[model samples]
Target: MTRIAVRHLGPPRLTAGLDGAARLDWDAHRRVHPEPRPLTAARLVALAEEGRLHGRGGAAFPFARKARAVLDAARRRGRPVVVVNGTEGEPGSAKDKVLLCRAPHLVLDGATLAATALGATEIVLGVTDETAAESMERALAERGLDGRARVVRLPERFITGESGALIRGINGRRPVPPGRKVRASTKGVGGMPTLLSNAETYAQLAVLAGLGPRRYGSVGTPGEPGTVLLTVTGSARFPAVVETPAGAPLGHLLDLCGTRAGEGVLVGGYHGAWIPGDAAVGTRLSREGLAAVGGTLGAGIVMPLGRGTCPLGECARVVRYLAAESAGQCGPCRLGLPDLAGALAALAEGRDAAAACETVRRSARMAERRGACAHPDGTARFVLSALEVFAADAARHVDGGGCGRPVLGVLPADTDARLRLEVDWSRCDGHGLCADVLRGLVRMDEYGYPVIPGEPVPARLEDDARRAVARCPGLALRLVPRAQRGS
Candidate 1:
């Protein structure tokens, strides 16, 4: 196997010296052969039809269909814009950053070709972290394609990378979605038609354009034929990026990661589901294969939960962090997520495990589709999966005092420490003013302590929420931002 040199800059990979144009290191794993040639829209479309290329960005939408949508919409109107989603806000996934830092030119080649094919005059590469954005910017300069493509910084929040939110951010608005549903392909970035896809997807397109379909299909499984970059972290000997065939076995990846047999595997990132330790079942890693087993290969984030840490406690901590990260744009997500987090915390504290499980179910149902974005739904899936996968742990917590092991904090937290508004039960006077003033922001529990919603207060309602914070009769409620919480 060929290994690409990558400079690890904390959670993301950063390239060195991006001030000027630099050549991408593609000698080992070039997706295309015969020295990539520029492909036009017609040829690209035909190749996509033949290769059956799909989005690598978890959605798995057909690439041909997306391209056609942009083309048709542009013809209906005028020129369309191509947006490369390199933000990769999924906490555990770093594949895009790997590609950007190591093989930056591959991504640029793909984006440029796609822009030309779609008749898009402008191309924007949306990246969140400073390193990846600079790497891509430098790559564009190396190719002397600076006039054709521009790189934009994306918001670091999880939901900010969604196509709609990205387009909204590009338009000088906050990187949050509007209340109503909107399609970017129809009206995006300055109200122009947009073709948006994952960074890797565009890179794959460049490869296809250069190599043609038949050659590109030679590597992976028939249904999903190509090489995929997977960031295999957790319990692995070498926790780095691995270029593997799309349908490579989960068992093989686990072995490569140096995980002991019988350990649980987190197939996807935070929003993904967990699976059992049967290595035999780890046949393939594609979306279809994972879906067949009621799981998903979301962004190719595979983490193995090693022994010694309390799985239940760790999962609860992750759930709490995910809850606090909610954008809080809609009623259900705003109301449901924190409650679910509370229940998970309760389970961690050795109280009401069964009831907490029920609360998780209820909260998930309430928050699923009501949010403007899919953050709530994805979070619900993650929490629900944890409940199912760790039934024994839940049972132990309910029947006994608690899970014996300490929380290892394998999952990332919203703050450096726990983020909750503490009510000095002794200091509390049941004025109900907090609830009255901030109905959506704070609700009085049975004991009169405020059960604050999980989502962030909308800009419109920020003042009202603050008013409730100020009007607390006992000065009981305090709004603690995640940064101040220290984890």
Candidate 2:
């Protein structure tokens, strides 16, 4: 595991000091913010606009408009609800988690402020990470806010953090995106207008409320004022959670994290585009700044694909994980995503590379705008961007047998890459029997090949697992006990 490196390029408001993890107790937290001041609904919305605050989540949606919408809904409907989205589900992103763990009170202050202004009696904080949940619980306890706020543990799947999905999970429904669009602001938890925002976004709000826009907006560019937290990982010397003012040079961040020269960087998260090494130079960090360079400041996940790693293969690994983690409710999840994953896998393996590349592009196109949520569109962006950015490698695989470079597994995925259910890809013939006999333990991918999750077989299923292994005609399957796995 890489050691986490936390650094701040400017004055550290969010992170208390250079040595990160500002675990401030209630009294200490009071020293930081002096407690939240009362702000009317319209005043809060106006402050968000003046602060130029956008969601720290991938979308970077304007905070003022969303708050106003929730306020309007409350006027027409009933008193609103507030949900602090602490479910940092993106495997590549950790900024929200870092804030939840280190500055729990900061996030709570923001949430409490929003809840009070919106006249929301309930402030449900949905957190996927147990540690983050624990941190919020501790912060709430310290503040003696047991009655005002509550914490709900959410599933850690890739799509479970979507607003509707999180609301569903809170509402005791399965934590998957709805089959169609359901605006949370209009009808969220218990059919009340909900003011839901990412945890970091709320923290930004708290900061804005405290600083009153002018001092808060002093550091960053005029358009995108205030500092932003970025999770810079992959191929960098050390994984970093950096707090830098907006409009900082993208190259500077890459260099700050020790990103190697001439390596492609995946801007945003898996749902973001890839920028070439040359293109990354002098790129800025704001929404427009990244857009000028064909990039998006998605969830603030930035990773440089290291030299000697097969970028396409690494992307395939993540896409495969993404496909398997789908809600499986819409056409994209049921068909398009699986096909995209399989096509990318074929491209990575050099099997029908020309046809596979075409299929990959076509699958991405087909998946867009055909889903209940932005999952499909975001996934399509990830796939099409890879094709465009890694065209040279695709061309190499198309003409030649394969790219000589190996997939370094640099990109993170939800699946644990443990030594458990093992398959000799060289010998596997898509038997389809493993899935039928083992049932949930082993499932077949779109290509009829087994898509074994990285989990140890349960003690009760050991015999069934062995039977499936024995039944494999090509002798391609086996289960390794945890003892032998060096766990």
Top lDDT hit: 2
lDDT of each: 0.70, 0.82
| Residue-level lDDT tens digits of model 1 in 217-317 | 87778899777667776555567666677787777766665665244677777778877666424657887788876688777777777666777777776
Question: Which portions of model 1 miss their true places by more than 4 Å?
Answer: 1-35, 261-263, 279-281, 414-469, 476-487
lDDT of 2 by residue, 86-189 (tens): 89888888888888887888898888888888899699999989888888899989988998889999877788788889999999999888877778889998
Candidate 1 pairs with clashing backbones:
236-257, 415-487, 416-486, 416-487, 417-486, 417-487, 418-487
lDDT score of model 1? 0.70
Question: Candidate 2: minimum summed lDDT over ten consecutive residues — where?
Answer: 453-462
* Off by more than 4 A, model 2: 1-3, 18-22, 416-487
